[model samples]
Target: MKQRHEVFFKQLEGMRNYLLKVADVTEEEAQIVPKGFKNNIRWNLGHVFVEQYAWIENLTKEEVDFPKHFNEWFGWGTSPDDFTAETPSLEELKPLLKEQIANIKGTYGDRLEEVFEPTQGMDTLEQVLLWTTFHEGMHLQTILDIKKVYECLIEN
Candidate 1:
């Protein structure tokens, strides 16, 4: 079980790195989708980056000192429309994304072996690990979808 946790973190880290690399090629304005429901790649990316801290702190009962207003900006209770489409430049957000992945991989990777109080039907460490990846994977797909729309907008 511990070994599986280790493997999942590795895979999670790889997926996160891939998403960050994709952001490098995305245009800044293209990172904001106005007429659509989704919050563009930047917001989705930032949301996930922020979630590392949120989830870790929730599970580990430790202080993470995450960005202020992150909850308001990215919390599930708050819609993307709650804030303007303003987002940091790729240069800015890129490091944040990388830093977040580093923090999770370095600080919280092994910590997953500890028991997590069940929430939302996740009863074991494996379930929480898998659910986190599932959440991330959904946004990764959102990034790709937003990228396609961004390209179409530019070409048109």
Candidate 2:
């Protein structure tokens, strides 16, 4: 039978849809750092993907990592002003954000109850999925706030 945590993917899908709605914009738009904000929509988009993957890989003692550049560009403590020539455009990040969700679904949908041997407390696949969902939800709200500020700045 399919893993019981299908609801987790459903929640992620809702979060993904909301994040896409906020992150949908030109590369130039996604690059804007609103007056009080350190990062923009693009950073949050990449972050939502990176942090989830980071938790799974780290907590499970798995070797999987996001692309090398993801840590540099979107890792915690990263800021939008740190952009280098190699920073991904919103166009690039948008699809990858969705792909992250789809990849998680494919990887964990049937295996959520499978033991993540490295974890002793809250180490189950279900807990990882749960934590990732909460993290994504937080980022979704942050993206919404950033988008509003960015849009306001654009207008005035």
Candidate 3:
């Protein structure tokens, strides 16, 4: 693996752990709110998985094989309210997260040199890795905010 890929994997693992910790709390207080900018805990988790899956698929051209609904619920071009379907429980998401991470490691670990191409703006795999890390970090903050709402709802 390249240095950039290695660093991205480390960062991804850290963020995944952090998000799970936050989900543990949020899942305990699951409540339906009438309105909000943030998606619920389940939506947030699925979003993380699907986004990573999207990036991996884009680079490797491998099918991620996530459930069909996930594509509509949290796919590349949609936002939280795009679908009216209920979100899955956090317990339901843990396995998928593990599987996705394993698939990414397996497929990309050896194929780094051949996997990515410099596109219109990005000129290297390192740039793609950096973008992916930033994407995960952005969602980490969103997860934190969602956790705060969960806490407030529980307290009220």
Candidate 4:
């Protein structure tokens, strides 16, 4: 992989690491839907995971491996209210989230510059990956906000 491409991957890994570290909440905490928030930490985490796969698949025009029911449980427009007992817990998602960066790097490291039919204004694999990083970063902030709200509620 080129140095520039590696930078994107590193940025992604760093953000993912920060997210996992910041989300040190218990499963119960992860599920808590703080007032004014439509989703919980668990939903944010799962959405990040599922969205990454969806973006990669769109760019590659091939199926990206992901856990089943991820779209239903965490895809765009999904809500925690829709989650069922079969929905994977935060524990189940952590490892998958950890593994996703490596999977993406290994699968697309050499194909970064490859152009595809434009999706979301991204015509290159590199562009899509960069977008995914930004998307994950946004959700990381949401997760942090959710955690803060719940923690404050507990303290009050």
Q: Pick the candidate with the highest TM-score.
A: 4
TM-score of each: 0.78, 0.86, 0.73, 0.96
What is the lDDT for 10 in model 3?
73
TM-score of 1: 0.78
Task: Kindly list the per-residue Cα lDDT of model 3 for residues 1-156, writing each as its tens digit.
Answer: 678677777776776776677667445543333256545566666777877766656665567676767878777666646656365666877777756655666766655556355453664444555676677677667767766765686689
Tens digits of per-residue lDDT for model 2, 70-146: 88889999987777889888888877887887787786677677776654366677788678778878887877787
lDDT of 2 at 95: 79
Name the lDDT value of residue 142 in candidate 1.
78
Clashing pairs in 2: none
What TM-score does structure 2 among the candidates reach? 0.86
What is residue 42's positional error in candidate 1, in angstroms?
A: 1.5
Off by over 4 Å in 1: 1-5, 79-88, 123-126
RMSD, one per candidate, in order: 3.0, 2.3, 3.3, 1.0
Model 1: weakest 10-residue lDDT segment is 120-129
Between prediction 3 and prediction 4, which has the larger TM-score?
4
In candidate 2 the C-alpha lDDT for residue 79 amounts to: 82
Scored by lDDT, model 4 comes in at 0.89
Give the alpha-carbon lDDT of every model.
0.67, 0.77, 0.64, 0.89
**Ranking according to lDDT, highest score first:** 4, 2, 1, 3
Candidate 2 CA-lDDT value: 0.77
